[model samples]
Target chain A: MTSVLEIRNLHVSVADKPILKGVNLLVKQGEVHALMGPNGTGKSTLAYTLMGHPLYVVTGGQVIFKGVDLLELAPDERSRLGLFLAFQYPVAIPGVSVANFLRTALNARRRAANPADKGIPIPEFRKLLKAKMDMLQVSHDFAGRYLNDGFSGGEKKRAEILQMATLDPEIAVLDETDSGLDIDALRIVAEGVNKLAGPNMGALVITHYQRILNYIKPNVVHIMLGGQIVESGEADLALHLEERGYDWVREKYQEKAEA
Target chain B: MSEQVAELEKLSEYKYGFSDNVHYAYQSQRGLNAGVVRTLSGMKGEPQWMLDFRLKALDIFNKKPMPTWGGKISLDLDEITYYTRPSEKTESSWDDVPADIKNTFDKLGIPEAERKFLAGVGAQYESEMVYHSVQKHLEELGVIFLSSDDGLRQYPELFREHFGKVVPPTDNKFAACNSAVWSGGSFVYVPKGVHVEMPLQAYFRLNAEGTGQFERTLIIVDEGAQVHYVEGCTAPTYSRDSFHSGVIEIIVKKGARCRYTTIQNWSTNVYNLVTQRAVVHEGATMEWVDANLGSQLTMKYPSCYLVGEGAHGEILSMAFAGPGQHQDTGGKVVHGAPNTTSKITSKSISRAGGRTSYRGLLKVYKGATGSKSSVVCDALLIDDKSRSDTYPVIEIDENEVTIGHEASVSKVGEEQLFYLMSRGIPKDQAEGLVVAGFIEPLVKELPMEYAVELNRLVQLQMEGSVG
Candidate 1:
């Protein structure tokens, strides 16, 4: 059976101001969807609401993943239910190594799945982490450094991807992961996403620029404006927006609202 | 219900709340006066000069008034049993120790630690030493490790020369109290050019209710010698508050180095007031590692006096304050000679309405040119109800001295918590990880087993803090 995430009439507010208004979308396993729009258009808001950020209040919405209500759960519970958000600005946790954090996260997931389950043995966990790091082309020394503490832009993005690979979430929402990256870093991150998306997982690639869409080809493309997704089309729609900027989409949505 | 029974019921959650049923060979009456001091001195069969010293100390203790700073104190001096002798003699072999007392140390893991790494071990129960031993090789190197009473009885002249030189009875009221009724603490002397690799450990336990334990520890590191001394303390919980006032004096000779580490985890019904200081000679170094985790109220400031040229001192202090606990601890460094240097680092955590304060002083004398000092204090508050404070004083009379001080107070931010929890960690465990990171710098300096134990204790303290 294929897993599905259904977002219907979702409304979100931040600090008493609405950011996401009546948004609707559907994502299924083995499919990649791209969400593109101008800045401040509720792209990241939708991602944060999907991951249950406490600051993003869900005033009205129903987010069901695998037939379970995601909005009714805590952030940790949402994560344990195979929902992940690659944060735009990852926070640094000093004195916590990447290997240690990953192992703790894995153990938490295991214990949640079965109450009587002892955590992964140290040797086995080490082997698993090494395998994942090797698969992602990450240096072994990266595991020893403190989690994102003094990391550069490219390093932080790479660390995020490394975490995504280690966690193996079923549905990942990439919220502007390409914002602070150079060209080389952008290609590497896009390749990491491409490699992770398969029949076992689905992805919602949220971005502002069309350059990343060129690398990780999305099966369906959606344009968001004014707290609502305004356009849905085939892959060529991103190319159309790249040729002409969001000015045309703004005008089009303006005419539609007036009518 | 009686007060004692009610206190025992409240101590069910404490790990070391189990008390022994052994009979004390001798116990002083519940009071402190001239007669009590005389009886304590007479019981030890001390020299006349020592008796005179105790009598003078009693006068000073009576004259000094109670302090009105740091944590609050509600102790009644007239209601405390000042002296208790659990066994008649200190046993050199573990098998010779009384069964119940040995069982207590066994549960505390003293013998296992001794067999694994410690060069010497001293177990003090109530007011007397019950078990004492040193590795045969260290004993062959002219190293003297024994109880304070045995040190006086066997090596009187050496003990008399350096007993109270570092910290005298006139220093404070608690120091004077310890001076009058001091008993059962470690006495160590490392000869010139001899370096003992393993640490010498002392474990102090208070068993009786409404009693006081005043242990006097004196260590002397001779020229070019090196040693590390560690002491850990814990007591059973009771409704009636107990009092613990100890005085530790150390001397580091020319080119010698000494490190003293203490892990204090008394029960919540105890007031722990201790005075520990060391004097460093020319080209010598001294370090103090102090970790305070328990007790209703604790006021301790370990100090180092750099009295000779080219001396150095370092202090690393850590404190954890849980519900109804107040930890007032820091370090002091005094530079009396030229070309001296010192450093102090302190870290504290407060949770569940507990409070912690860092009170420190750095002083450089008039002629102590080219001296340098640095102090840093960092505190973490786990919730809105917790509290932390810092008071640092620096006095530099010399124009050519260098000084630096930095302090920070931070709460566990919601963003940090959210970031950790979003990765599937529960709220309480997430808070625990952040706290472990905040105190990582100090915890890394502890030994392997102690580092593990400290982390475990911090985890245990964080369990019920989150809703």
Candidate 2:
């Protein structure tokens, strides 16, 4: 099957300091891929580069999403192309309610899919929003609050999942959604991701812990070190890495680099 | 940045720059003197006391040199026409107003707003109020809403008692100028125990060039009464600069509450200098929601004198300065009675080489024990060339008082922009949302229509900032 997202020899830097060096990855439809790595291994850098963050310079690479080259697009264009990133730390946008933000995102995606689309009606938008919130057990009051303003860590994570659910992106890159979440929140977020996983969508869950995968049940797992993938295995790879830590992976990558 | 500069060049095109083709019944010669003041008062056929008051104010205005402390406003007094009255009489009904004058208010959606939400409406064209009306039910409830001139003619006792009490002619240069030639403003009096649920609105429009608009507004909320008054001002863009110096005085009697909201969107050629003040009586509350979005230069500070024990005052100010515009505005509160409190929140945004400043004063008197005051001023600069400044003075003569102040100046955060854009919002829209959020505290306090207009103006200011 053709992959939903293909990243080849991805190289990215920030302020002249190279962070993502020659990374390669692929995500197929309906498949959940887990990216595990230690701290400072540039996991979040890869996610940001994939989302076309301006600060993360794409020195050399090609990111193909649904036969379209993502590097040539703006961040909003990338998002309109069904690429979504569940940020580990979502920025607080005061005065913009969550419902309004979701409606805008949904409208942008609809307009992108068909230029003639006039966007969704308000009543229908509210209904869809309520349905999504109910699916994740989010409170109705969350829709009225400012976008992530004064939200707790778990609330921010839940809001991110809520956005993924509402936008219904083709491929989602969730960067460390598990960090800072309590057990109940982790389960709920993982369940949200699992419920959204189907033939029409793919997910790349970047995390440092094996705990989230226990609930997510990733189809494939990859360990990253030194800005490159060091090993690929089944979901068990996450458990092994969590138990043994990343020293072995670092050693293997060092030896490979020397060779 | 080059694209932004190109966009800034297009900013000179004003949206409301259409001149109305009409002849004025009375247009003062373009200068100021005792004769001009006499001419204005004599035209209105004022009583002897009012004419004397006008002459006294004119002398004060002549003696008081232009203020040197605020934004640099290069208004040539000789070039400005002191008065321009389009209509000979203030009409109580829209049908009696001239068609040309009515068309301007129609274009501004004033009648529609009045129908939907306002209990009364006052539409000022040039120098005089061409139309003024209050709902019959509100009138029957003893609510008095009329033109300042009509208020003096009809309710002379009430008008004379509160006209210059809050903001006297000697307060400042602009106040003296406004007192000398004031016309076309709203005078609302809500009687005791009566609450006007809907807002009383006043719309001021300047159509003629080289003219100065001086409107005096007086509002008295009687004991146990409540009211909300909203005023909006705009002028057609002109090559020769115009001047606007108005005075607004309000009195919140004991156990009353009053909210005054002003949305000023004048053309860039106008210098807007105004003084607004209110006195909060025992257990009364007064709120000032002031938004300044346009003008070549603006220097306004709405103040409240908490004269009665346990009174409360609040000021929520929002200022937006675009290219070639300077907005210097803030709030002042004087706590003169025991247990009084006041709060001031100011938010400002500047872009495309514009400047914004927050200059506020908070004074707690010696006899006022247990008084509290807090002031917060936050400014956002969209580009490096834009500027913002904060000057807050808090003087405490009493030892038993709590005072707090916080000020911050910030640029639009790159991370926040990315966070919004990652969710499919365009760069310009994202920036607009950030700005709207920055002033959300103040905008939320405005009426619904004003809030919507404020957001649209913010979006217009944020246009072309993204490359």
Candidate 3:
């Protein structure tokens, strides 16, 4: 199967300080990849770099998405290229409602996908939004509220997933969505991700714990240390890291460095 | 004045710059004088006392010096024509108006907006109201909606009692000028215990060149009554500066409520200086929703006097200043009686080297015990070149009063823009969303039509200013 996204030797810096020092990864359709490491290991930096944040300067990198060079695109252009990032902390836009935001995103994506396609009509958009909200178990009233404004931790996560479901991006990067969510919220988010994951969608689930992997099993698990991936294994590797902690990974990396 | 007009002529992109080709039946000489005031009074056939009031106001206007505070203004009094009448008399039907004048109001969306959801409608062209109408159902409910001139001719006793009570002639220089040369505005009166369910609207258009429009509006909501009045102002762009100095006074009597909403969008070469105030009596409420979007220099502070126990006042003001604009606007509250309350929320946006300032005052008199007041001012500067300022004066002599003031100035956060763009929205649209969000509290308080129009204007202003 052709890979949906490929990141090769990606180096990024913020404020002139290098954070992601040559990271490599690949995501293919119909599969879930987990990138896990301790705090301050630059996992979030990788997510931001992939999403084209201006603050995260890409020093040396090549990001290829569906045969196009993603590094040369703007954030909104990358989003139209079917790339999605569920932010660790979603920003609150006080007056833009969830429905309006989703509709705008959907239209932008549609225009990029097909030049001649008109935007979805309001009634049709409402119907599709209703279906997505119902599938994600999001309250109907949530769509009328401002996007992420005054939303609780769980509500923010659910709203993100709801957006992902509406946009139907080809590849999605979930950046620490389980950080502040409780078990119930974690299950709901994982379920939403699972329902949308198939031959049509690919996901890179970035997290710090193996707790969420229990709900959404990953095809491959990668252990990142200091800015680069140090190890890759099957799903059981996540459980092993949970039991021995990041120290075990650090020791393994240290042996390799010394050699 | 000719030099400024020559300068403004260099920028020809003003959409509403075209003037109609029509004859003015009664155009006064191009200046403010006692004879001009007398001629206006004579033309309206006013009583001797009314003429005396105008003459006294003219004396006050001459004695008082120009205001020195707020934004810098270079208006030459000698260059402004105080009055001009586009038609001989007010018409009750739009078809009866002169075709040229009718076409002007037609382009401004007067009758269409009136037919939408207005309980009463009034259209003013230049110095005089050309058309006035009220729905039959509302007229049957003992509601009196008429032009100020008609109010004086029809209900002289009522007009004489409360015409200049709230904003007197000597209140300020602009107030005195407006009192001296005022010509066209609305006079609305809701009887005791009757509520006007729909909004009464008036549209004022300035189509004459080198002229001044002084509209005097007075609204009285009697005991246990309720009313809402909304007015919109627009002016055709003239190379020479046009002036708009209006006096809006409202009286919310015991247990009554009144809301006054204004949306002012003049041409860039206009100076809009005005005084608007209200008096809230016992158990009454008064709300002022003012939005200023255009003009070269505007200094307006709508105030309220809480004259009875348990009175309440609310002011929601929004200002957007584009290039070559300075909007100095805020609200004032005077708690003159016991247990009165007031709240003021001001939001302003400045971009493209424009400046906005919030100047407000809150006063609690010596015997106004147990009163509470709060003021919140938030300003957003879209770029480094733009500026925003806040000046709040709070005076409290009553020890038992509670007063709070909060002010914040912010630049558009880069992170916020990135977050929005990551969702597939373009950069210009992203910036527009952020601005609309910033002023959401104030815009949401406006009527539906005005809120939509404000959002559209905000979007248009954000097109080229986004990073």
Candidate 4:
């Protein structure tokens, strides 16, 4: 079976800053991969470069998502290839209701991938949104509000999960979804993500703390140091890092990178 | 002035021939002067007071010259005919109206529109109204709906009292011209504590080229009375130039509410220069909904005066300028009383080398404490050849007042279009939807039919649009 996400020797930069020097990672189908790193270790930068943000430039390497060249596509084009990005700081678009925006996005993706089948009608789309809201334990009034306007940290993260469940993208790059949430809210978000994640959907969970991993146990743990992952292990590394901290990995990887 | 001039006038006749088709028994000669005012008054057989009003306005008109602020004003009053009436007698019965005049209105769906929803209907053909009527129930409530000519006849004292009160003859040059040559328009008066539930509409159809239409409308809503007046105009496409300079004056008495809507879609040859003003008394409200779609050059700014305590004003206007057009439109509000409020939102779209401008004003008087006003001007330039401008002025004399003004001019971003097209909406549909979304806040304030028609017109104007 093909891997859902494959990033080989990925080198990316931002404004002459070397964020991701050389990173290699692969998550197979039906798996959750958690990349744990300290500040300025290129964890979130990898997510943006993978999702094809306009500002991030991929200097070298290839990103193959389900046997397709993800680097050659635009942000929206990458989205059409069933790739989703849950930003740490979601942008707000005032006067655009959440319901209307999501419907437009979903219809656009559908029309790009399949031409004969058009967008969902208004009533049917409303029904789908209502059911998704109920499943996510979100209030119906949330649909009427502008997209992420004045939303709380927890609400914004949960809204991301709600969008995830709606679009059902093949690969979701969760960029620090647990960064701003409290422990309980983080658990709730992890539970929502776990429920939405399945055999067909692969998730790349990017985070700094190890608490979210307690709720969401990843199939593999990748340790990022100095803009690249220097160590790969099973979920035990998450527990080890939680007990020993990132200095151990950082010092060890610094020596190995120099060698 | 010369024999060749007379022969040349005879040779280059009207491109649009509605003047000759809709015949009248009594009419004034071409051009304007003090003698023409007396001639037009004599033709109408108006009383002495009406004749005096016209003579005073003629003096003011002769003293004032054309405005110099705007760009490329092509008004030639010397070559323009000041008065041309379509009928001698105003008909109470619709059947009594002439066949050609009725057919002209029939094409515009006036009869069906009146039957479906209208509190009153007044149709003006050329310089005189050929048809005017009000519902019986409204008449029973002492609601007066009549043409300005009949208003001058029947309500002479009331007409003289409020005539040119809101906008004086010295307000501007074209205003004085309109006051002097103004013939037929709608007159509305609602008694205290009564509300007119339906829309009172006045349709001005100009069918004659080289003929100038100067219609003056006055509306008075008594205390606690509410009314909505809708006015629409259209002129047949003509090669030769036509003139339309209307003056609308509205008075919302203490605690009364009134909304005046004007939709002007004249042909490209018509110079649409109108002056609309309204005064709101204590605890009253006034609203102006203006939509300008077609004209060679339109310089119109509806003004509102908040005179009494707690008066409110809202001006929602939109302008669309296509090829060879200049839509110079906006609004103004003056808060005179305490706790008054006002809002002005102007949206413009220009393409095909056309120009759209927002020139607005907001003023708060010295004693008007706790006053608030906001002015937002947004212009969308669809191509490089088009132009858009905004000039907003805000004056606050009181300590406790809030004023905000915002202006933005931007082209349609390619990234937005690409995003929409990626979603499967065709390029044109995507562009249309984005444009509609840009103006959604204003369109939602309009009536349903008008909103839909405006959207359709926006899309049609952008047809075959290319960078």
TM-scores, each model vs. reference: 0.89, 0.90, 0.90, 0.76
- On residues B361-401, what C-alpha lDDT tens digit does candidate 2 reach at each position? 99999999999999999999998999999989888999999
All candidates: DockQ: 0.69, 0.78, 0.73, 0.13
lDDT of 3 by residue, B333-444 (tens): 9999999999999999998898999999999999999999999999999989999999999999999999999999988888888888888988777888889888888788
Model 1, position A153, has a per-residue lDDT of 88
Worst 10 residues of 3 chain B by lDDT: B115-124
Runs of candidate 3 exceeding 4 Å displacement? A1-3, A111-118, A255-259, B1-25, B88-133, B204-212, B233-241, B465-467
**lDDT for each residue of candidate 4 in A173-245, tens digit (9 for 90 to 100):** 8999999899888988998888877787888999999999988879989988888888889999999999999
Compute the lDDT for candidate 3. 0.82
| Model 2 agreement with the true structure over A1-259: per-residue lDDT tens digits | 4447999999888999887788999998798999988878889999999898888998998989889999999999888888899999999988889998888788777877888998899999999999999999999999999999999999999999999999888899999999999999999999999999878789999999899998998999998887788889998888888888877877777863332
What's the lDDT for all of these models?
0.82, 0.81, 0.82, 0.75
Q: Write the per-residue lDDT of candidate 3 for residues A5-111, one digit (tens) a residue.
A: 99999988899987788889999877899999988889999999888999899999799999999999999998887889999999998878998788877877777
How does chain B score by TM in each prediction? 0.85, 0.84, 0.85, 0.83
Q: Listing candidates in order, what is each one's chain A TM-score?
A: 0.97, 0.95, 0.95, 0.95
Which pairs of residues clash in candidate 1, taking residues 3 or more apart in a chain or in different chains?
none
**Residue A196 shift from truth in candidate 4, angstroms:** 1.9
lDDT of 4 by residue, B1-467 (tens): 34433422442343222222223354455567887888888888988877887788889888897887665776557666676553432212333222433343344444443321111112333333332234565688888877777777888888778888998778998888888888877778899999998777564222111123688888999999999887763312222226778899999999999998877666565688899999999999999989887778898999999999999999998888888899999999999999999999998888789899998988899999999998988898878999998888788889999888888887876655544433334556556656666676777666677676666656655764311
